[model samples]
Target: MARHVARPDPRAHWVLLLLGLVTLLAALSFHGLVSAVGGGSGPDQAPASPAPRAVTTGGPVLRLDGPTPVSRRLPARTLALTFDDGPDPRWTPQILDVLRRHHAHATFFVVGSRVDEHPELVRRILAEGHEIGSHTFTHVDLTAAPGWRAGAELSWTRNAIAGVTGREVTLFRPPFSSTTAAMTEAQYEALRNAAGSGHVAVLADRDAKDWQRPGVPAIVKAATPQGGAGAVVLMHDGGGDRGQTVAALDQLLTRLGTQGYTFTTVSAGIGAPDSMVTATTGARLSGTALRWAQTGADWLTSAMNLLLGVALVLGVVRLAVQVACAQRHVRRVRRPRRRLPEVVAPVSVIVPAYNEAANIAATVRSLVASAYPALEVIVVDDGSSDGTADIVERMRLRGVRVIRQANAGKPAALNTGIRAARADLLVLVDGDTVFQPDTVYRLVQGFADPTVGAISGNTKVANRRRLLGRWQHLEYVIGFNLDRRMYDVLECMPTIPGAIGAFRREVLFAVGGVPADTLAEDTDLTMKVLRAGWRVVYEEGAIAWTEAPSSLRQLWRQRYRWCYGTMQAMWKHRHALREPGAGGKLGRRGLPYLAVFQIVLPLAAPAVDVFALYGLLFLPWSQLALAWLGLLLLQAGTAAYALRLDRERFGPLWTLPLQQLVYRQVMYLVVVQSVVTAVVGNRLRWQRMVRTGEAAALVGGAPAR
Candidate 1:
């Protein structure tokens, strides 16, 4: 029998989720990993080291104090103009266009990492006859940068510029420093370090301070010449908003042109060749690696964006559909039912037990206590080593029979009980499920319609004293019942759970007495009956108390079997999609929905989780938090509505938010694992959770802990 096969391990979902989590983290964490290996900064190129140490000495301590770092002002009437921290796609182009308007050429000192990201910008600079200078990788204040990193900063920028422009650069600018007067001890040290590395320290004679954004007027005033024949004017083409800098550029150019000051590259003013023979082999390799790492981050970020988009779309659709359908269902069920002929048929209740000694006696006793006048309870012991049969015998109750059988599965056990049953109405239940007094009577009411062959009952969780149990309880009420209300109204109700369902003996027998083929005997059997032209409806008023898995591990095993078996049954009956008559109704109304919402939606749900993590790590915390709260709110409202429909209390909804943190992820992954298992053609066995007799008190209406 199908239910007799090997069951899935409860650990399977965790293993699968763990593997998927690792993969997602890998994608999101790619930049960090690469940065760690290469000893570089992230995409934004923030300083790699902590804040610079305080240097008390004030005035510049560079070449002006001597002659190495700073070059003298060009011959009278000359000006060498330079911009720093540039190649920003947003601001750089604006600065370039402004420079173009004046038909002037200037040097742009580019950050190496930024160049790796926007290599074409470097090429554009060279193509425009603009000189390139090294701004150090990541814009670190080289003075305070560690020993291992300082050299790489300058070398990497030179190589990155050369890699794209095919020309080496000798002009260097120590970040946050200028000519002799403006340099500090740290700045002097950094400039000397650059000279040692064969770089000419390019310091400004005038500081535009455009990077400060002290208005266009302020920047123009700062750059105005001191009536000098030559000067090195400082400005910025990149970093933050450069609108003021760009606007101020045209003003400075006109002012300088009026004063007869000519603009030239930093090297020409210093009287050296603008280009060098080569960028070192090490620098080029570092640049290439940075280029590749950036490319990877780009791809991963794009993938995450795509995933988030799809998840958002699907999530919204689901929420809309569920909310709309649930509202309609609530209103419809609230209306009084038309009086129908009372269903007084005697019911034969069948409890199939396999190592369920824990709750067998209580379940049988609950059936015996049903208010229905005529009742016969039959307990089928499916070869339990645990004295389940002995427990039934100890009850010595009337109208109840125990049929001991070999170790066949649940379907076989149910078949045995059905055969031994003497009544026309049959109620099938698991050993762990206990019923209310009027459950059988209310369940059979659905049989009033001659076409209605089976009725599904409301199965509630009895062990909801813990957080996990409470989550399951919510699932039973919202996920299962809300779905049934919608599907039943659509005339395409699919599953009639094993815990509490009723069927006519004739219809049950026609379906081969509970089908032993699939692990989900209830689902397989239900669809078979539907295909056989029998109508199935859910009876929400017929309540059955069943023990829910109290631990995540147990829940994983049970849900895994349920999800996998459901996939198999869906595949087995897929031909219904093409059928013309009764099966056509199922094919048209039922299968597409099951395929989409069940199979497709679940497989893609993990993307929401992946995107959530990405947003936390790369995007803003506010974005991730808002998105999470919005989803949680949607769920909370939906859960509240479901509880109202089920006549359940609102208190359970308190746990709904926390449930998103863990329980929901587990369920999502279980569905994912099921899809993977089905796609790979793996056979899944029926898995049963260990039963505890705690449900006896719950059925007796004991207060929840």
Candidate 2:
């Protein structure tokens, strides 16, 4: 049973994150490029002279240099009405409905920007038998605008219009120009410039000044024809609240019909075929590029939304479930726990030391000062160059043994200590931890059931002077202790921290004496004991104070090792899930909880942050802020409850809110990098943390007051 087998390699969930980040960046880049390309021509295009209009006092004043057709003539009793600057989401639909209700066909000069924003409206414009044409891309004055900008203003809109509608737009309307006779120097120059390009310029014969939002009657009077040869009336369906425009259009159409006049599209009224792009400009490539760009952007946006939704639901549900279970355990733990047997057997305490000279004395002294009558202390120094073994040997304390060996690892050192011990009950302690006098006695009492293989002791951080230390202290209580309550109640407690835990000797021996393959040997061994048919429980009364990492770098490294190692152990023991019976409850109950709360939830936490940023930029920031505060309050409540249950003071929890802002994200990044490294086959070496001799001071001589 002590023989070990090879474990499975890693899974590549890390790729999902890599791909997710890459694709998200790609989507953002695509959007930016589309914006630049849609709204601008190349910045290097040459400047051009001001556009010239047909102003000569000649017959017909026909502008031959212009690319678009100039038409002011029409049949009798026929009105050619044209709408420009459209595809406005709010007003466009109302205009479309009015056109549909009145059975009218009018040309809409759609702005490229609005088309991109509301492509559905552009489709509706085309679907409703209306002619679509360019409105200078962004309503810029083409006559004074640079030739390159003007060129792109015309061409990009045509490309985009085609991109969305699969139809070419050839009709052009110079922005800020009203009619053939009523034109400014720049407007006529713009007409000449646009005609130099391949677009037909359409000028309205009548201006309603609807954009000024003059009263409905004024707009009607401006647009109402006064018994003339067919006229081209200009009204707007977009750019602002077109309620008055819609009303004015309805009134003018009723008045015109009563006067026996018919409405037609601009192209029809101008004696030209409907405008459509029949030739490709520059977009006729493999077609895959645009499709891929669109698909990737769409997918990334959808994924972000999905992540936000899932993270919100899972975070809330897990918090609720864990809190409810913890409360139940609190009520049950208040009931008197079972007492250890009358025969308080002899016990062996193992202190694994590796370059721990700064703190070994406190560990040995705490164990030696134990109230239990029968106790033996073994200090296993795994080749500590810091004179750790020498310190223990120089103490010359009775029944204290020192074993020196090459630097293997904590697991190997522990196995050596187990072999040297002569007692059936064992306690394992890290060299930096200081235990209470009665902790060992309190710890072993859980094994009174005979079936209980191991008991986990409550480990608290002794160093809490720094902000990081305070955050860790809060985490130890709220995250670790509260979680242990639920795990203990479930009978599937997985880890017996190396800081302070007692195990029955035979159970440890049966489970292969701490395999060195995993970083979290303690967790690996505990799961082995469970699979080997042994029960594990948490004993909070057995308390020890250990030092936490002092800096963010140290904290990151410490957590990386722990998280990566725990993942390894979880993967290693995954088979236990298939086994039936009460002993496999660790696999059935404990594993799922760890997989979710520890692994999956932490991995998905970035979604909450990402979504928070997304909401800040695009969604309702006030609601997002409220949701964040609610989660923080929920965490505060949990921390308070755990502290009360542990008999710990709540002063450190003042930093809890700050922890959410900074410390929590650091831990999340640690988990993310750890998972990425683990999946990518990056092996992590075991390194010792630099501990300050501060552990003995904060918890010196006895338990904290």
Candidate 3:
């Protein structure tokens, strides 16, 4: 008996990994690492008490900590140019170029997140003899945020600038703030809080309103101070398109120079010390680490988006191909054909049993009840502790025989049955499967063509009254059978499926019988036959009903084995890629398709789900909901079409959406575990599902005896 050995569950490790990824993405969004899509912060509109007359009428630079506020005006013939919402990669450099050409200096109020992204720009600003100030991390409105958040915003921005330039800034600018006269009470409180931390508030004397992207001429007029009163001018170097800002800066500099106004940094205009001061060693190191961490987060976000886009495109293409090929296959099979001799070859049915006493009686009975005249059934019981062989023997059905053997596993028992059989055509089936009376007869019809070597029969779920069973039924109809039809049309059918498939006796022996190397013996055998120049095809008219796992644990084990075995078989036959004829077609077409849709897609599915959650939480809900609904409708439409093709009722498909939440996740994890096991080179034994004998009852037979 192939018993399962206890091993550490890898689910905890994968779950933790997925959670970590989601957390990182959420953190990135919260911090605003990516640029905003629409525009800069809107103008502040909340009503509040006006500032004191002395402060409002005072110069742009103010020291508000004392009982009486102290302020300073810019020197005569001087203009203090300060840019906010930077260091943008696109517009900042152009503004810097204009300033460099005019030999002018300005203070850049940098957002901490943007500084993390373009640290080199911050360094460039410092190296070029300009000034830097804190614009608050993420460009958040300090007046609207909590006091703690406002404090952290200022601290984070200072650290970011210190990381790049080895300096800390004493000057601060609140997001969406204007001239002192326009300041609200909340804004003043925020400024007072910053003053307590040694930050001097830097309000603008002139509002260029350049972020509005008015014509270049309008921006220039708004920025030019009245009568060279030595005023502080505000503008933008970030936000949306700054073409007007850049053009206005160049023209403003030239036009203002003719008016005898010299542009300089904020501190220089006020005759104060430079706003930037050298930072302590500890701050610099921690800030540098923060910079690198944010950079990595940005890269990860971009890579994930690219991967999701690619997966979406591939998924759509796969669906389109499946529908097209399935339709083609239907037309080809239904077209009228010339009359030919019916195939009545004697057939041997092989049933490999391991602890399958619960299902053996019905399996044997179904075989004996086949309508075909020349049929022999061989039940090979492989060391079953349960009385599997005895159950079949007690039935005493005509043309049925039972052979007992030690537990050498499924492939060895299958080979034993083949050698003892007395017919030229063979049908392979699992012990838990129940067949219709005409299944074997219809299965052999493909043998009428001399070149056809094997046939794959359609497999259905026999215990689909429960939700789990219904989910499996949907998968069988949409995911499996539909793909089989497509594969048949493409002439690259990979596996004939052990639940129900037919093979030629000679073809089996020529390909060295059932392969023992992989757990999926049927797939291994089918590939061997294809490599030997025999065409394997699907016989949809022949159907077998098999028991699907009722519990999640059982489903996980079954799917893990299947996925791992298929991967092994694909690897074992990898040389077919270089071979000529049918082998090449299987390699070039079938293997890649399986790798992308089966292996790679499942591996990527969890990450996609994580991203979808991220979108729901941080992104626009309406857009995300519409996108999810569109995908659901596409899947439901495909499932409906597949069910129609299989002559199944549409009632099972109502559970399809629910399956995405539960069953689909289980399948994804199965692929994950299988891939990890394969990569680690661990050996997986045969996992037998406990049979309920429900399949027999579905076909009008008695339950387990």
Candidate 4:
């Protein structure tokens, strides 16, 4: 007898949200496994789980079987000879030939890199009648992962397959078949979710144990039907040493054929099948023993998905509001009346250096050359083993003062400079950055209004010729520019960015100088300033160009630090959450905007991801069409905004879909990591960003003011 799966409660929305979060956490943890191994796929013919509904009322098949049981009893006699961790030139073709001779179809769960390396093989697989499944970008296990890494494995794998075969792969077979039942449930749902609204059906039984290199006779013997007629068999053609699999399958097919058996594709046997089982609830039912169980599961899943969706949406809306708040506050500033204050007030420029021997002199030189009349350049050398102070002293830069301090972090260094500042206005610059000739003037322009507490400058990528550099350049242009504009409109500038920013000396003191422990001291200060009801402004023309990471390793480290720091900032300001008038200037505008842009948007991203992967994998033309339409509109809107900003790069814009393959996961990582760090009170000491060969040299080229 088929057992009835217990249903979840209708009001279990919170549970669903928790489940979603758990799934997200699982995805992050299983990232390496998914990337290095693969995820599992649902039955190819299994229609996409219906779109979320208030009460889905179609088929009466309400008996929920455990996933493993469902996979075992799928009413198809055809075998899905799925070989994971492959695209190997040496062995895949041999297996393909054997399948061809028997006129049999199989599924190949291909790794992303292999697909790229051997596109022709992928093309051949698709053309020859075998279905393709994602073995992750590099055969990663998606069951025990968290953050961007998990999302990357799923998304990148899908994208690579799509690129090679032009087919949207819906099924993912996890490598090693290693996920526990609980882990599988979370991972399958998350991958489905990350794929954008698709359901993944995991295989129940493994017939041919090929990964172990069992002898050909053992392989054939294992696959020979032992239980009832219908069964889904698994075989391998990848992940090393498959010659035995090739020989075994040939003999198995011949044996099955001689036994008066016929081979059929999984879909061919099931798609549009005549007989169908309908499970229905009786009309007189008032939450019966069975009815309750059916509705319970539906209710639980629905509530959870809905709540998570709501939380994600709310977070994004908050960020948007924050951006809008910043803009409004900046626009509220009255026009400057007097020219340069006649007897120009002295503005102190603080340069924070820690072993910045290669670039400190240039930074000091830029400050000394600043067109602002009465400017003091204070270089704080934070215990550098290198002659950073010596270089500053050797330059003999006029109006520049060098201060030696112990090896303190950026925030500490900033505080030292702030305390020593002899002027009323203070500007903090990283030692590795350079400023435009008019940077200081522009930074100080916003100080005309007494209500303005701090000013942030426009930051740009100085080196963008390399591929990685171009990618970073595009990121700065689109992400930062959009975020800044939105923040300006919202009125809460998260931080007067440290690269080139100014604050009133008194205002700095009011906010208690720079925060020493937070990785993003700049952001914390900006939030604190807003929480105090003061405004932060952006000087768009005040350009400061800094070197972006030039390689993947450097890029990863830099981003990890940034994401970790941003999480820290969010935690410190979490008091603003839903509190009436809790955020001061930011609460009213900035906090709300940021919640929308940063928090909600990323969470919502999985929705888009689920919808997209569903459409592609299941070939649901209608749903796919709708999702694709939405995606097109989103791109159109983003592109228009990018164009309006004059920062449009045709290549990045064109690769939007592909970029999303990796981009969404990156955002998800930031979100997941932030949440975890918040809960654990994770503390991170600042790690200096690595600057590779040319990147190191290019730091010297930034134009001194």
| Best of the candidates, TM-score | 3
Candidate 3 residues 1-705, lDDT tens each?
899999777576677767876676675565343444223546656556877778788888888788878888897779989998888899999999999999999998888888888888998998898998888877877877898888888887888888888998999988888888787777788898999888999998888888877799888888887866788888988877888999999999998898888888999888888778899887788778878777776776677789999998998999999999999999988997557569898999999999998777877888888999899999999999989988888888889889999999999999999999999999999999988899999999899888889999999888887899899888998988999999888888999999999999999999999999998788888889888988989888898989999899899989999999999999999988898888988988888998998899898888778777767766788998899889999999999999999988888778987999998999998898899889878899889888887886855642221
Q: Candidate 1 — worst ten consecutive residues by lDDT sum?
A: 36-45
- Model 2 agreement with the true structure over 166-244: per-residue lDDT tens digits: 7777777766656555555566666666667666667666778787788899999988767656777777777666789
lDDT against true structure, model 2: 0.77
Task: Write down the TM-score for model 3.
Answer: 0.92
Q: Write the per-residue lDDT of candidate 1 for residues 316-417, one digit (tens) a residue.
A: 786677667767766766787667688998889999999888888788888888899999998899999999999999899999888999989999899889
Question: Model 3, residue 191: displacement in angstroms?
Answer: 2.7
Off by over 4 Å in 2: 1-104, 110-129, 134-157, 170-255, 271-275, 279-281, 284-296, 338-343, 699-705
The total number of steric clashes, by the backbone 3 Å criterion, in model 4 comes to: 87
Q: Give the winner by lDDT: 2 or 3.
A: 3
| Two-way lDDT contest, 2 vs 4, winner | 2
Best by lDDT: 3
Q: What is the lDDT of residue 305 in candidate 2?
A: 67
Better of 1 and 3 by lDDT: 3
CA lDDT of each candidate?
Answer: 0.77, 0.77, 0.86, 0.63
For model 4, residues 1-705, the per-residue Cα lDDT tens digits are 999998545335436655875564443333323224432332233224432231122111111223321222334344545666678787889988988998887777678656655678887887887777666665544555665766766666665655554455556555545212212344444445444523243342444666667699998887766543544566766666788888898998888777655565444434423111221233113213222332343354455457656764664564455346444544554444555353257899999988887667666766777788889988998998878899889888778889998887788889999999999998889887777678888778777777788888888776666555655665666677656766665565676777888889998898788987677788888888777767787777687877677666566556667767776787788776554432554655665555655666565666545533433543457876785567556655555555455344455455455455665476565565555555555565577865332323433354211
